[model samples]
Target: MSDDDATGDTATKPGDDRGATYASFVAIGDSFTEGLSDLAPDGTFRGWADLVAEHLAALTPGFRYANLAIRGKVLDQVLEEQVPSAVAMGPALISLCAGNNDLLRPNGDPDALAKRLAKGIRELRATGAEVLLFTGVDPRDSPVIRHARGRFATYYLHIRSLADLYGCRLVDLWSMQGLRDWRAWNPDRLHLNETGHRLVAAKVLTALDVPDAGEWHKTWPLPTAPTASRTENARWAREHLLPWLGRRLRGTSSGDGLPPKRPNLTEWP
Candidate 1:
């Protein structure tokens, strides 16, 4: 399918009567925003942010976009490294998704993370851009991260509160049942797969009141077989889990030397 078809049929329509023409967009956060597991043919991640940008660009001429996100980045890194650049660009739309990495850590502090996130939102809003916030989906199907569901819930609630307080748009991933399915995830069972990213792009557009043809909340087909077996889980643990744990132990990150794929707010191709 074409990018327009995958994103939404109405995505190419001109801005609605509200005059919500997004001339530029900037996405800031971690691997989720960075598009991990949604690999392009060139081996780069073409995540929801990119898809959203493309959708908007098709509708608005001279629509520029930037994505300042890296994998395995905690909220602090995002606030410190990305927020400044995003503010400088001064895009009409900005989407921020962070704190999930921090929440995954032991003894994660939801309150503290929320405070930091709120500060960033406030700063972004000061720039007069429509800031978009996200609540991560529940990873109930993932044996490894499911344990942190309580923490995730706490953080998600806090995010909702911030969005309400700051008048920021919220993309409530937590309520998306489709994301809970293993089929939407990659081999690592962490990041969303290509289909998952497409759905997210559709949802984000919908949340922004951007015209789109695709439905983000559509139900997936029922599973024909049982979920992952013990043996399959074990293999996953060995391949994806152990390495992540090791990184935590050594205070290393998967995005150690990586740079944002689209750092500048250039016109979308």
Candidate 2:
């Protein structure tokens, strides 16, 4: 298990999707899950969902990901569509990063929203998947989005309660990254860029207890200012976690003895 291979630690776990391994992963959410406005089709996991998958693949080996996230899905959509798919997969791990759209969509009934979301979570967990739930991020200020100032605290509570009732791991990204910086947001302010995504990934890994989680969070720096330069973003990705993630997927290695570490950007160069 070396950093060079970046994936040697869990590269061939028993449940990995490849071969006979039964381990499969599914993501459930809205546009954020859809990787909206993300630079590439591959980067469609514009936020933490993709990052979590990337890290889990390293630890679980042969792990396969089935992103069931859809655009503009609210609580109802999740219960109707995403939840059923995830339940059928019987995934080893399920990440539920949703509910932002429920808050933004017009005429959403909060009580009904909570009820449906809870049911969706209950069903996912019933399939024996270890559920990892994520809280929503604050919307970036935008002209087209009319209700930017709407209260979202209730959604957070509902999500947290569901996770607790289901006995699942919860990553409060809204608290960890969202409330901390306006800079962490993209220009559109709706989704995350590379650094934002990396931070979220680091948080998720820490929750999962993969060995390298600590290093990923502690070593990475966060920049006080957002970078408009895609080059800088690309460079950061190449130098850290993203490159290692690439190596693992390709079955390559860094040749070093260290485990592949997640990159953080709390204080980036």
Candidate 3:
């Protein structure tokens, strides 16, 4: 978006809560925002978006939050299903994180993904709400996903560009040094573990200029370091990678027929 394109300041920087008294928040994306591996005691996803919402609720009375993200969704799906609804609600703030599922594909194009994302941001901003954008984590360390590092890096650049152009708040997860640890990931190595999700929540809150986002940025130690044993790799391939491939080959999605965890903007619990 150009300077003449956007109407409001939307969001500025680290602590630029300058008139940013966001009373309502809507998160639209994919599994990451849906909370994935970060499960509540009830075995449901409660990822970073929820944490941010909870914190914001305490700060503002009647603060409402909605997360319309479903697992296995790509950028197109999110824009089609969730973006329209979020735009209709006209929340004070909207955070969007997606496109990784597309980039993971053999035919994924970073430039195309960025263009699609930029279009969404433009539409969301037109609703007079702030947009919070996220960059994908570095994939250099993961053997399975390492080959996509170049693509992800390119996508990150586009993400930053769009955020700057649109004056949207940015939660640059690729800059999170703590994510380099394997313990921050689930056994599948494709999603964030509880620790990783908590850290991401902190980053998002910080971007929104929320105080006391927590000490999740610190490099906390884990009981067990990540390993590269063949047996372990085999287990992951069998249980995670193979299944994911099978689903793709069968033209199915893990999130098929699933509903948004939080379909409406209600007071955060």
Candidate 4:
């Protein structure tokens, strides 16, 4: 379906609770799935996957969760390192969100990225897990990443297609109007902030036919003043954009030495 066509209601109705159906959930991908920017007090990222898992755990006794996602992981790395382990765990639910790191690379190919993503999804599905996929939020709000808006859109379209082909539930972030707001993003203008992650968790649950408090897409209160002024934009470029570009040029990644937060399918803390 076209992006516009796909922009109807969320995957499931409001107030529909289906959390009990899932006994376990494993999230795999890059920093986004690893929960960057949505940091915990102990200096760890706890993104939407953890939030969703917490809700699911509350509903089902002995619910297990694992997040095998590491920062800066490309699609190939995810397939090689994380996917196999996630499949071995045999969780009833799996959420995969990768390729943003690849998309940010110079001259990245969306089609090739989509193929890799599809392969991982298919492999996960082979384990009889209900896979969850995501279309990235539009990055146009960021001055730096906005240069590749066209490429990002193409990648998102491919992701939508893959979700359809695999019968995976999709958390269509591309169509979520709330994400377009700059406030939804972290200072790095890459990862989503705490509020943004919360919204994503709600959407993912809704996609899974789970019940939630019913306010994932609510618009933020209007900013009293303009946001992302020239000075702030310049600061962002210096602080976030330049470092990221340096990493890319040096052929390094943020996840260089970082291990997966929850390497095993264990009880949610």
Candidate 5:
């Protein structure tokens, strides 16, 4: 997965949205983009992309979404395939979440990841979508991911620079939050669980200046100055249960006092 080499995660069906009258949103990246986790099943963009979409539906009047996320996709693959799609859609907003796959895929070359990511950024911006670059937490904290933290940190900062260069908004979850916060991740310790996604989405919505962003903020309050361990499972439970209850009680998925039955793709790799 060199910067020049292209590789992608498992193949997936493009998202389905034929009747949406809302502003189009396109997401590009790897498992994080695809929402790979204990909570998200295969072929779903369960991460912040979905959360953002849900929030936007409430505020934007009528926003649609197109997730170009492919699991295992390196920066190069996204630059080639996903970027073009974003250009075609001319989405109102576009989010780019890459680099993790470059770290995970065999032969993943970190040295050039920044360059490839920047290339993708340039293309996404060309589509006129207000590009949103999401800087997530370091995966190395999990113990299973092997790259050195220093290297990933370097790449992360460089990606931030690219975002600034492109004048795109950045949601630096990594900088704003700590990885030691267990509530930040699901049980799999890889992709973000529902709680993490909500937090990330709220941050992005605020950063992007999206309307009514506060509605997407954390519904569950942290245990008065919560410790990392205490908040971990509690956050997980909130992520799983809150949305379900809200949706069920409301009886509508999107409007008129009903939240869409946005089911979590709670499957595995």
Candidate 6:
């Protein structure tokens, strides 16, 4: 697939609400799954996974949800730490969205990452849990990392293929036209913002056949051109991008000792 649009949308058909109902769900991945930029009023992360869980809880009473995602976790960390624990929960549904952190690394190999992801997904599928997968956002529009667009595309294609092989429901984030807007992201220009999270949650519910998923997919107005101006670029480098590189150089991560936000499946209050 040469373009981002070419890969996804093959796994789960949109608007095909199969009336599926899951009693519980577990989301395992990196910061995206952990809801970094999408913060709650109380300053807690409440990203797309939480929103999807909310919709699922609405359908099934006493629906339990667990989020084992941590910030800055590479695929290996996710597989080694989060995946095993999520599998143990035995949730009826599992959403895996790791590998972005790995992709950001200079040595990141999409093919090798895909192989690891497939193993994790296969393990999740073996438990009779309906696995949810995702393709990353298209980086073509982001000036900061647009040069690596091909790398992200490679990962997206692999994710699409893996989803098909494992029969996992997929939320094709790269195909969502609404997220092309810069307003969908926070200042870091990496993680999705609250609006982006809302859109992603809608996509996830739609993939899972949640009844009210349609209400969240409204068309969004484009930003005044999300192009990175010189000033904006400088600010992003100082505030977000440079620090990320420093962490990589120092062999450290933001989630070095932090625990999962929702480590256990419990009724979401």
| Per-model RMSD to reference | 8.4, 15.4, 3.3, 5.2, 12.4, 4.7
Predicted model with the maximum lDDT: 1
TM per prediction? 0.91, 0.65, 0.91, 0.90, 0.66, 0.90
Model 4 per-residue lDDT tens digits across residues 1-269: 44333333233222223454688999999988988899877787888888899999877889999999999999899999999999999999989888888888877888778766766877887787888899988877767778898888999888877677667888999889998897888898888899899998998888887866346886789899879788988898899889988999999998998999999999876
Cα error, residue 48 of model 6, in Å, equals 0.4
| Candidate closer to the true structure by TM-score (higher is better), 2 or 3 | 3
Candidate lDDT scores, in order, read 0.85, 0.57, 0.85, 0.83, 0.61, 0.83
Clash list (residue pairs), candidate 4: 17-211
Q: State how far residue 174 of model 6 sits from its true place (Å).
A: 1.1
Tens digits of per-residue lDDT, candidate 5, 1-269, equal: 23233223221222233222336667776667666552545543367777777776665555677776766555766788667767776776778877765564445565578766766776666655577787657655554354556666767777676665667777887754534456667664556777676667777777766666653444344657644465665674576546635654664321232211222221111
* Higher-lDDT candidate of 5 and 6: 6
Evaluation by TM-score, superior candidate among 2 and 4 = 4
Clashes of each: 2, 16, 0, 1, 13, 0
lDDT of 3 at 16: 48
Which residue segments of model 4 deviate by more than 4 Å?
A: 1-20
- Residues 1-269 of candidate 6 have per-residue lDDT tens digits of 22232233223322233677889999999899999898798899999999988888888899999999999898988999988898899999999998888877778888778877777877787787888899988889886678888888998898887777657888898878788877788988888899989988888888887787855545765456656788888988999888988998999999999999999999977
Model 1 bad stretches (over 4 Å): 1-19
Better of 1 and 5 by TM-score: 1
Candidate 1 lDDT over residue span 18-133, tens digit each: 43669999999999999999988888789899989988998999999999999999999999999999999999999999999998898788877887777787788888788889
Candidate number that wins on lDDT, 3 or 5: 3
Rank by TM-score (best first): 1, 3, 4, 6, 5, 2
Residue 95 alpha-carbon offset, candidate 5, angstroms: 0.5
